[model samples]
Target chain A: MDNYNYASFPLDMDDAVFGAFRTQAPAAGDPAPDGPVTDLATGQRAPLSALWRSGPAVIEFGSYT
Target chain B: MEDLAARLGPRGFAFAFLYVREAHPGELAGHHATFAGKCDLARRLRDRWQIARPILVDDLDGPLHAAYGMLPNMTYIVGQGGRVLYRAMWTDAASIEWACDYLQREAQERRTSKRVAPFYSELRGFRAHDQYARIFMNGLLEGGGRRAADEFVAATEATEGRAAADRLRAARQELPEARP
Candidate 1:
């Protein structure tokens, strides 16, 4: 799914759709992909690598909606 | 999450909440149009949810989110050197705490015996679904506005959706805290 296109709310997240999204994702033992992220504390942009640089990171991806 | 951070942070685990695409976009919580807008929404989320963990806001269009599977509330425990240790479909604090503990034990074992190495495995992680679904929907509606409830009712049937709203209206503890 394109990141921009939300495909609307209450999506038909059936077993197949969930499987496609889950199976294609990065899995255990794979190198975590690094990208840009804005650290909320300083309100400054930073690389995703920064969060993990200090130690093992537990990242929970989400949003308000 | 705060308690987990307090207990495990000292043990060298850094916890974060990565802000991503809005799951249910509506008037109040629309699609991320700009980076600043997304950050503001993220800040509001952190404040409203009372999440103490550092909130990392993903860029608009969310390339990072797409690459990581784009699940709404997925949890990932990434170990040192950027190796993924555990990836669960949903964030379950208890299960995550157990994983952290397991990782700690694994590191100790590795110190004693050099045979320990990262390996691939999967499991069906569970979440407190029934009531939490209601809670999650309430959040979506809060941010997304009235249309959120309307679409939800249309999709899940007005009876089912109204039942949830009624329960929420007659609520006691909406956000249940789990303490160790």
Candidate 2:
């Protein structure tokens, strides 16, 4: 089991926002990865990386659509 | 989070999710950008989460958010003296539960020790949470809800003490564009 410490990460909205934008969304027509996914509440386009660091995330793709 | 809030009640701790700007507004690769509808998305999420606590809307001007330097999905526990005690961001559930238990203990100990001033002393952490909830609701209404805004106007008046009505006038002065 992973031990999560709030202080370890501290709170930096800047870094989190920056890192989210750096990740690439999956390409159109790409096969969906196997798992449950939840889309971001905003219907904005986002790379798979920005979807979430871990756990389920919402997504859109050509293959799925 | 709603379940946790319910369990903790007004005495344990209140949770509020501040909806800041979208990290990735239009696309994943873009730099910080703002979205028109993202705030609504946040509202929906709060509702879906069944969060009973308040979720305040941080405006485009970013006044409140700038004050807190808040990160997404972060939780802060403010003790009875208006002091922040526990803070967590990008957390795991198990750890958060443990921290919550610890917070409850701390609140209890503070109460038992009777170290706090009477006026500032809290019997349950929930009261503070409720207060924040009321404040946040007013803020949320101020964001766009007509009734919420009206209610907030009233609340501001009440809480502002002898200057309640005057504060409303000041608030009106603060937002000139809001005038007819």
lDDT of 1 by residue, B1-180 (tens): 778888888899988899998877777777777788888889888888898998998878888988888788888988878988888888888989999999888888888886965567778777676676557556655778656645554554443456664554433235332111
Q: Could you give the C-alpha RMSD of every candidate to the true structure, in order shown? A: 5.5, 20.0
Q: Roughly what TM-score does model 2 have, to 2 decimal places?
A: 0.40
Where does the lowest 10-residue lDDT sum fall in candidate 1 chain B?
Answer: B171-180
Q: Candidate 2 lDDT, tens digit per residue, B1-180?
A: 555655655443544445554332212111122434545555555555554554444444443333333334444444433443443334344444565686566557776885643232211122234344345433333433434344445544544444754555455444533356
Task: Please report how far candidate 1 places residue B133 from its true position, in Å.
Answer: 4.4
| Interface RMSD values, listed in order for every candidate | 2.8, 20.7
Evaluate fnat for each of the predicted models and list the values in order. 0.80, 0.00
Model 2: CAPRI class: incorrect
Worst 10 residues of 2 chain B by lDDT: B24-33
Best by lDDT: 1
**DockQ measured for candidate 2:** 0.02
